[model samples]
Target: MKSERERQLMEQAYAEIEKYQDLVHRDPYRLRYHLMPPVGLMNDPNGLIDWNGTYHVFYQWMPFRTGHGAKFWGHYTSPDLVHWQAEPIALAPSEWYDQNGCYSGSAIDDDGKLVLFYTGNVKDDQGNRQTYQCMAVSEDGIHFTKKGVVINLPDGYTAHFRDPKVWRKDGLWYMIIGAQSKSGDGKAVLFRSSDLCHWEHLGPIAGGNSKWLGPFGYMWECPDLFPLDGQDVLIVCPQGLQPDGMRYQNVYQSGYFVGRLDYGRAEFVHGPFEELDRGFEFYAPQTMLDRNGRRILIGWMGVPDQNEDRQPTVGHRWVHALTLPRELRLVDGKLRQTPVKELKQLRKQQVAYPNAVVANELRSWPGVEGDAIELRLDRIQLLGSMMEIHFRHAARLIYNSDEGVLTLERKSFVNGLTETRQCRLPRLRSLHVFLDTSSIELFVNDGEETFTARFFPYPDDRTMFFGAHGHLQMDIEKWEL
Candidate 1:
């Protein structure tokens, strides 16, 4: 049963949304193929699941402003991930335990019902924080009934424990949470449950003074554990990761660890933590296996603690959008992410270029200029030290053969000055670029490395230039998304 306060909040939220719809839609930076809040702010993709032939995704939303506050679980649903519709709010922070916010979490199919697991965040008047692993049930996958707190904050962790990702394996339900130890180190704690409502604390399976993994971060925000090709993968976002050469440049980092999880001992024997995206704007990624048995992931396309005010969309009363859904695969012991195959459904007005030779100067393509389109430069013969693709005069993706590094450069949203983020690659193979209205995602070498960022060029500036220092050969294909 819904309380009167929750009902009133919903009514007011709908009114605010209606009032801002036109203003928000008028923003030129509005995305054509990305999931964004109709109003206010969005972060951290949450409660991702495939249920009854529908793809459901939820996010942390602050509908009243383009900043953080008491959050609600905003939802979207689709028959396929390619096309989506904003659904009614799934979970609200109206109850006593969750009055402050309903933070990030995941979802699962409990028998036939859609069950969601998330963190309820509360801050008392004294500034002390409290967290609870909460659950909700949805018969129709739209409206969710709150089941209150299922698991309180366990011992040895601070209130930073949140973002519960629950999955079932071997006839038992398991959960992993992002946490900060009382001693101020990041950790991923484990739990088990036979029934969805009752959970058993299984201790810290990864992070926090582990012998195999050294001190990684001060606090881990979102941890997701799943299976990929017979091996377990743990995806997490850790805060306070200092810059390590070309990686960990952002305020926080989201990455994964490929390993084996010992069920009985509740331990994850894994390799070194690897950054999932070698980019500036990918975080809090969540994955779910689809009906076709493919593991797919989606991430928030903006970074936190960065240029919050400088985003042009904030003037229109919205902040961030989700990345295009990407399919995840374990290739050669590394996670390879490619845009989901269903996105081909959005392709239209195909254009192709035969194998082309490039010289020292950048050249623009006549048919490949658009704010929202897909471009593929394949079969590349890299005969140059540097290959550059200038995106709309605002951002550029540069490949340097000398250092074997791929760099993305863009004007800082804060200072309007040029900045760059880079990652090392062994060799160059192909470049797959997806350009939405205000964002760009570069999938390099068939998704071996990806760079995701939001770049706001002038609305009319759709020109892209391709340049090589010496000479390179590649084919190009593009489709308006």
Candidate 2:
């Protein structure tokens, strides 16, 4: 039964939505083709699953305001990824187990019912934190029945344990949870269950101060474990990583490890963690296998504790959004992400400039710019020492072929200064860019590397400038999306 408190919280959230949704929608910086909250702050993509030909996406939402607080699970359903419909709120923090918040988790289809396993967050008067691994079931995938707590605090761990990612393997159910050890080291542990209720601890599978990893981070949040191709991939967000040049530059980092998971030993022998995105925004990504046998992943377009108060959309009563759904693949032992093909359905008014050439000067193409557009540059060649593309004078993509480095610079929302993110690449090739009203996603060299950022440019400044120090050649295509 849904608790009365849960029902009351849900009603309050709906009231917030009904009161401020229109006001939020009037913001010019609102996204054109992405999932955003109705009227408040949103973080972490949670409970991602594809069930019965419909895709369900749940996210962490703070409905009363544009700041993080007691979170509710906001729901959205999509027949095709290009179109999304907002569903009723999924889970609320009404029950005692989850009175504080309903945090991140995963979903699975079991016995013709949709099963959701998520973390219940709680805090006491002295601000002591408590956590529980809880479950819920829905026959129609709409209304849900909470199953309360299934797993309590395990021995030798703090209340920081949360974000359960579960899967079925070899006729048994297995789960990997993001946690922090009692010693304050980050960990991803394993557990097993015959039924969905009772769980048996299987010890830490992979974490800091274990095996080759030493003193990695203070906490690990939002861990996902799955098999791709012939190897297992573990994706996690680790906090307390100091900056190592261009890496670990954000407050937290989300990356992955590819290795083998030994079920009997409950150990994961993996490789070094590689940053999933090299941009200012992107955290707590979740993936689900679609009907096409593709691994589709989406991430929160904003990071925690990163210029949240400075966001322009917050004044309108909503903040943060989700990145485009990208299909994940393992190519040459590294992850490759490209916008899912279904997004092409949003393409309209195709415009192409074949062999657009520039030399020793900056210029603009006749019809190659818009605030919301899909720009594709094919067979790109850096005939000069450098090539730069400036969008609306707010963000710039610069490639320094001499240094073999690509850099993204955007005007800071807080200080009005130019901020840059750089990653070393051997050479330059093609560029696929998605320019939304207030964001840009750069997929370079056929998803070889990707950069996602949120920028607030003047609505009228849709001009794009291409500069080549010496010479450049490429075929460009623009589609208003």
Candidate 3:
């Protein structure tokens, strides 16, 4: 039963919805085609599934303010993954098990009904935390009936265990959860169930305790295990990760391991962990197979404990958005992700410039500037040591051919100083850039690597400049989204 506290929270959320809608109506940094909270704050796309011919996405949402607190599962439905409509809030943190928050989880279609498996978080008077693996069911994919806690905390692990990802394989249900041991080390535990409720623990598959992976991270937050192109993939977000050169530069790290899962032994024989996104603002990515059999994934476009108050959108009463829905493919034992084809519906007023020359000076082309747009550069030959793309004078994308490194530079809101994040690539060929009002996604070389980040540019500054130290030939296309 929904409690009085939940009812009061819902009323406040609705009131803030109306107020934030009016307040952000004139906000210039609002996203045009991305999914963002209507009010307050949003993080970690959860319960992603395709049910009964429609797409459903739930996110960790706190609707009363711009900070993290008791979270509700905010809902959104899409017919083609391009157009989206906000639905009513799903799960509220009102029950005894979830008094603190309803954390991240997954969704599954069970016999024509939608079943949501999530984590219910609680903390007691002494500040001791508790967690439960819970479930809820929806017949019409709109309204849901909470099933409460189905799986409790087992021995040897602390309450940091959460974010259960469930899937059915070979007529048996399997789950993978991110967990922290009582000793405070990251782990991914495996479980199996004949029904969806009662589960049997299968022990840790790969984590800090493993011989190959020694001392990985302090804690793991969101864990997802799935089969992609004949290989098993484990996706997780590990907090308190120290930087490894260009990797793990953010406060936390989200990445995946490609391997084969031995169901008999419940072991994952895998490769080294590789980061999924090399960006400043990416975490807690979740993936699901759609009706078309495509492994589509979305990630939160903001990181935790980094630049929270520094975000300019907090003044407008909202922050954070989901990355563009990307289709994942396994090519040459590496995961390749590209923007979904349905996003093409947003393309309009296309402009193409073939074989353009970039000399020593910055140059702008006609119809090459907009806040909401898609830019593609292809078939390029670099004759210079350095090349750069200035995005509205607020952000910069630069490539140095000599070092084989591509860099993104932007002014930090905390100290008003320039900061950069970069990744090394073999060569420069093509780039696909998606620009929203407050976000940017750069897919390099047909999704060999991608950089996703949030940027705040002036409303009137819609100019883009491209330049090279020497000279080069390139083809360019821009479409207003």
Candidate 4:
């Protein structure tokens, strides 16, 4: 049931992938166990769902060049979260309504069939833009049928309205979309559908200049709303927030507000916003509930338009990846992210040190070094005010117990100068570190605080250094992942 134009463009995208197969595979910086594009640019994980015992992940892909343009919905499927297989392209910019691009949205299961909701991006010769909330369906989760536009541009909002996240609540289908008001303030709009085809607008639930917040940002992108623990969480990316002290330091910010949603009145009463990840890269996260009843999350490891020209992977016709699937737990008022237990299957070599002590001078353990591995330290008792662990001489994780601050430092992608990002931690207990070829994911104090970043270090340098102003004791374990 595919249109002629849609079928042709998807074939072209497959051909593009085949053309760069060798070049892309030969890149030294390619991820070892992460989901990356076969070629071109990738961003904003979309349509994540666990349907019929299989996990499906789709994303925004530009297949022809290492830059952003009209995107194709590239897909990957997994029986288990650790192993993945690339499937056919889900949506192409072929239909007239979506000829510009098939942008971000979510997925759902409807009567044993897989349903997808996405933004149909259209543009005219003069570069004017129009957006449509569109739908598609698949029998096998591989090929999608474009149902065309189901909803038009509503009144009082700009065409920036996109990234619809839908869920079934109280036997009704509800969707929340990121939007820009006519007055140029960001917001999240609410809608309801009885049959997933017809919809009724429920007005704005939350965002800038709404019931609670002031003018926060000009445009909000990629919104997600779901119930976690005993409360509701709304995650969104808001643009145009200037840096205030230690937070909102990125080009933009991705964070959440915990509150209660009144479905009857279409209102969301929430608390203050808190930053999601204290890292250099981590944004546009999507989540799903698996059969095991775990709320798992994944995010794009690169920010939008943040030193894209400096990315080394583009030389090989590939750039960017999605982070490892992380299990989410709402702890003490904030969400805690930890690597799913399935990732332990990637562990190969095991190295452990019991009651290891480090003091004064920098030192290296005999077998604690690799470009791709996981390091776990438990029951760490610091005898000094400060301790520093350097990774491959490329990045450093420093903790100061006296100042109650933990800092992550790495060389800048734009300039070689050292750059640092910090978050407050009452005390340091455990440090879990994952090191990939060109990236790092640091989970501190049992996921109470986490830092995720991508840094390019010397490929040959796999040594790690640990130093302390005074003696510290801890249990250490390392595994090659």
TM-score, one value per model? 0.99, 0.99, 0.98, 0.98
Give the winner by lDDT: 3 or 4. 4
Question: Candidate 2 at 398: error in angstroms?
Answer: 0.4
Whole-structure CA lDDT of model 4: 0.91
Per-residue C-alpha lDDT of model 1 across residues 256-291, encoded as one tens digit per residue: 999999989999999987898877788899999999
lDDT of each: 0.90, 0.92, 0.90, 0.91
Please, what's the RMSD in Å of model 4? 1.0
Prediction RMSDs, each to the true structure? 1.0, 0.8, 1.2, 1.0
Model 3 RMSD to the real structure?
A: 1.2
Return the candidate ranking by TM-score, descending.
Answer: 2, 1, 4, 3
Stretches > 4 Å off in candidate 4? none
Better model by TM-score: candidate 2 vs candidate 4? 2
Residue 416 miss distance in model 2 (angstroms): 0.6
Q: Tens-digit lDDT track for model 2 on 124-240? A: 999999999999999988888899999998988889999999989999999889999999999998999989899999988899999958889999999999899889999999999
Clash tally, candidates in order: 0, 0, 0, 0
Cα displacement (Å) at residue 254, model 3: 0.8
lDDT of 3 at 94: 81
- The regions of model 3 sitting more than 4 angstroms off are 1-8
Candidate 3 lDDT over residue span 1-481, tens digit each: 4567777767778888997798866678989999999988899999999888889999999988899987889999999999999997788888898888888999998888899999999989898999999999888888777898989999989889999999999999998999998888899999999889899999888788686587889798899988899999889898888998898889999998899889888888888888888777999999999999999999999998898767999999888999999999999888998999999999999999999999998999999999999999999789989999999888899999999999999877677678888899979899999999878899999999999898877878898999899897899999999
